[model samples]
Target: MKSCYLTRPGLLCALGADTDTVAEALFAGQQQGLVLEQGWLAHDHNAAVRVGRVAATLPILPPAWQARASRNNRLLLAAVQQIMQEVERCKQRYPAHRIGVVLGTSTSGVDHAEWALEAHAAQGQLPEGFQFEQIDLGDPARFLADWLELTGPAYCISTACTSGSKALVSARNLVQSGMCDAVITGGVDTLCRLTLNGFTALESTTSELTNPLSLNRAGINIGEGAAVFILSAEPGAVQLLGAGESSDAYHISAPEPEGLGASAAMQAALRDAGLDETSIGYLNLHATATIKNDAMESKAVDRVFPHGVPVSGTKGMTGHALGAAGALEAAFCYLSLTDTQGRLPPHCWDGVADPALPALPLVQVGQQWRPGPRYAMSNSFAFGGNNLSLILGGGA
Candidate 1:
């Protein structure tokens, strides 16, 4: 495969509305964005749950794009707006058809549908603005393609939590296969009753702050946000060094307990990057704070990095963004690569560590990576034993 670079990035998440604000908040270990809120449950009687949300006001879609209006697209728009200039530059450098849009999303616009359904149950008709296209899984990509007037390949990947990471992988393939000169990639997802209620039914949520790798760790706090990256043949400061994916299909909703599949993904990424395990300086763990996820990930990480590498689970501050979590965490790694201070995202959790799991070197608030070539690995594992690992290298 040819070298594929991540030229520019735009991010909106619980950490902050843009990449700079988010990078500052992430390095400081700020948890103010994660808050306990109510009104997400199926029944009004359910208690409030902690969730990471974007407090910033998102831009509204223009009247011309009303058919694709929804909170989900609004988040994606906020991110894309940050890089609009760069995206336009790409259009000038390459033909419109050579620029593609590929994104990942789990709840495209279902929140809007949920509200429309409520009104239908009581009013006997769908709301005036309600459109069936709002809830389509492919709406995000379609909306971007239309908004940017790009005729290249545009699509969405919806493989549970691996959606975002898989989108990045697909974008790289497009560039390497000579199908596109540049690709708009990453993912976006918004908080909604449907997503929260689904996790609640699966017993994968907690009322308190998420605590990863802690003895008293309970469950994950849901979050909403989006991260957008411009990938192309253009040389840039940061590059997508390697990508690996695996699916064990061990169970419908549980990871392979021993992490056999997870380890395979990491190993494959290392091989793809043409670097050994020791080359990685920091690792962004897929720490959802769930017992099974943490346990399985711990074993998988240990198997891949026996000598141990600095690792931290960022969900303590950003909450799992479901399908968008992969891109969100990758944004964290990208921020770290650009930081001159060599700062790493700290592990936020109780002081107590689980004795049953292997001991891993969790990052501290002021900890920094060694001075040299900076390579960070991020892992994302989803339902059905689907797993992905991405390696980002730069800031040498």
Candidate 2:
């Protein structure tokens, strides 16, 4: 497959409002971004959990997209705003029908609906200006397509945690197959009571700061954010070299215990990039901090990179962004390539290794980054055994 360039990228999360700020905090291992507060979800009126909430004020939606207004849309709009100029240039470079938008999301305005239902429960009527379609998963894509006046293929992907990464794969397919000339591809997800409470019900919500690969690891902290990347055939500083996908369907919530599916995805990614695992300088793990996930992922990492590569799970820095996680981490890798100081994102944990899990090298703060155009990979494993791995060859 021909290399697809990831040109301009925008990001917003608990770490920072934009890519540069987030990258600085991420590689420096700063904890100033991940803050905790009470009442994370509507269902949890009592139990307070730590969450990665965006602290910056959001922009008002355009009157044209007011009908689809929601926090999710706001986050996506924020990401796009950072690169709007480049986006407009691309629109002019290609016909409207030749440009595409493909995004991944988990909670699509579900929070707004939650508020509407509350209003109805008390007032016996829906909110005055409430629109029920805000909960639609495709709303983000539709709004972006409509706003851009793009006539090419536009759609949303909601494949659990792998949604964002798979969207990248889909975008590459569109460009490679001559279906489109340029693509605005990435993902957005907003925090909501449904996701928070749902994970809590499954005993996956941890009360303490998430401890990825720690012996005392509890679970994950739910979060929300957006990451947008302009992908095209034009050469750029970073390239989306390969993506590997697998659906092992081992369990609904739990991954395959033996790490067969997870390892396969990593191996496939390396294969797609035509590189050996040893060539990878840094690895962004899909370590959710859950007992099962860390254990399964550790085994997979051990199998693939036996020589030991610097690895880190960014959930401790930004929390788990769920559907937006894959692309968000990829943006981190993109920054890794652009950073001239050569600093790798450090592993933020308690330094207590899980005795039962396979031991792998974890990147520490102040560690020297890989020199030159290095290779990196980000893992995103979702429910129903949906696992996706993306490989980038640039700065690591």
Candidate 3:
């Protein structure tokens, strides 16, 4: 079997536009979220919840390109462009046809759809302003391919929150299957009235920043961001290691009580990695801070990693990027392994622990691990029991 490795990864989140800003924020333990003050929604008008919104406005593209893309696709474009900036360096080594693209997104172009509807209602015609090209799930991938001028395989995975992780898995499969030699895999999502009001209708939006594993933790706060990674078949590459996906069919919006599907996904990822539970040094948990979701995740983590491994959730800092959450969190895990010399980022806002939850050792402060190669895992569980886990290890 061929092993896929990450060559260069780019990130743009609320922490900042690049990896340096994100690293600085993580190391300094500074929180970047703020309450949404003004937006196009009723619930978001005076929403009290703090969101980790990107501080910089998205860069404007060519007018032609801008007219045919949605806000979320714009974010994805930014992240992909950052990665392409490094492609010239790799071009000397890999063939262009060997490269592929696999992206993860849930509500792709829903924002555009909403705008189209409003424009049609107001003007009594399909809005002359709205672009029809951007209202598709595959638009982001297609735009990225055109931007990079690559003619390889292109795909979009939309497994809700697990979409990003699944995209990574797809990239690995493409390389291993000899379908492509290199790939770009990641995720992007942007805040919109549709998602905000939808989650609000579900009563899943909280009035404050979430507290994962906290006794008083409330619901989740919706956030937006994008992350991309370059994967290649080169030796000494940061290997994908392993990945697993499972579905519980337990409920539409809630995980099963015992975390059956979550556990299966983690176990399968470890098995695919040819590793044991004890070998995982750190865990990037999918702690959205919601009651049922957090509780279910806690149970799953306790079942797999009970040896007091350092565990934290970046959602507290990044908010839940929904469709992009898996990719963003996986990028954090990959960065945590490569940048910090094996140290894991701490859980930034853990004020009180939940007594009813499992008693696993949660690393509340940033701590460094032994300097060397080590293994870490990232978990992403979405609505409808869609679960995905990725195992990443340091490059040789």
Candidate 4:
């Protein structure tokens, strides 16, 4: 297979609004962006929940693109703005049709729809600027394609949490298949009422800082942000080495007990990368802090790396970005792979580990890995048992 190089990545989340800011905060194990706030739940205005919200001022979309305007798209625009130089470089080197766009998102403009509905009920008409296309799942990709003027394959993936990582996998295929020479890929999600309330109904949201892999672990904290990358055939600082995907469909909302499906995805990624357990220097786990998820993932990691590998669950800091979680965590691994000091992202959780789970080597603050070609794996298991594992390697 032709190799796909992951060029400069643009990411913004609860950590910060750019790669450097987020990386600095990530290595420092900072959770300053995650704050307690209320008003997300319509039925309960007094309920304050800890959430990973982007505190930075976002760029506004031009009036020409007003129809596509939404917080979800704005977050995506914020990320893309960071990579404009590289994107322009690609435009100079390739035809418009040779550049593709593939993004993953869940709550695309749903918040706008919520507002429109409220206005309609109060005023007997849809909001003056509301458009049905804003709520479409494909809007993010469409907005990006029009913004960049790229005529290649542009689309969105919406398999719950795995959407973002799956976009990377699919973008790699497009490049390797010669469908495009370069593709803008990654994920973006915004805070919205539908998702917050939906997960609340499922009893999957936590009001406190999410405590993943801890005895007191309760549930996840919903977050919003975006991570965009330029994926090309040209070699770059980081490379997308391999990817594995599987859909076990074990449950609609819960992962398979014992992690049979999760293990399959991880093992497949290793096989795809032509590496074994010891080759991975670090792992960014899909630790949502939910009871069943943490338990199942523990077994899966233990099964794949019986000898133990350095691992960390980062949801405590970024909250879960839902469809963007996979890509956001993958971006964390990308940042780790490129760190000159070999600083591994610390697991942002209370110092407590559940004794019942396997004794995985969770990374601590100031943790550093050995010098050499660094390889890391990021896991994303979504609803309905959709799972994906991505292997990224940097250095010689």
**Highest lDDT: which candidate?**
1
lDDT of 2 by residue, 248-295 (tens): 999999999988899999999999998998789889999999999999
Q: What is the C-alpha RMSD of each candidate to the true structure, in Å?
A: 0.9, 1.3, 2.0, 1.0
lDDT of each: 0.92, 0.88, 0.79, 0.91
Give the Cα error of residue 174 in candidate 2, in Å.
Answer: 0.3
Candidate 1 lDDT tens digits, 1-396: 679898658998899999899999999988889998877887764578889999999997779888788999989999999999999899999998999899989999999999999999999999897899989999999999888899999999998899999999999999999999999999999999988988989899998889999989999899999999999989898899998889999999999999999999999999999999999999999999999999989999999999999999999999999889999888899888888888999999987999999899999998998878999999999999999999999963
Which runs of model 1 end up more than 4 angstroms from their true locations?
A: none
Error of 4 at 117 (Å): 0.9
Candidates by lDDT, descending order = 1, 4, 2, 3
Model 3 score (lDDT): 0.79
Q: Write the per-residue lDDT of candidate 4 for residues 196-230, one digit (tens) a residue.
A: 98899889888888999998898999999899999
Displacement of the residue 1 alpha carbon in candidate 2, Å? 3.7
Tell me the lDDT of model 4 at 223: 94
Per-residue C-alpha lDDT of model 3 across residues 283-326, encoded as one tens digit per residue: 88998888888888889988887676778887878788887888
Among all windows of ten consecutive residues in candidate 2, which has the lowest summed lDDT? 31-40
Error of 4 at 184 (Å): 0.2
Q: Candidate 1 at 290: error in angstroms?
A: 0.4
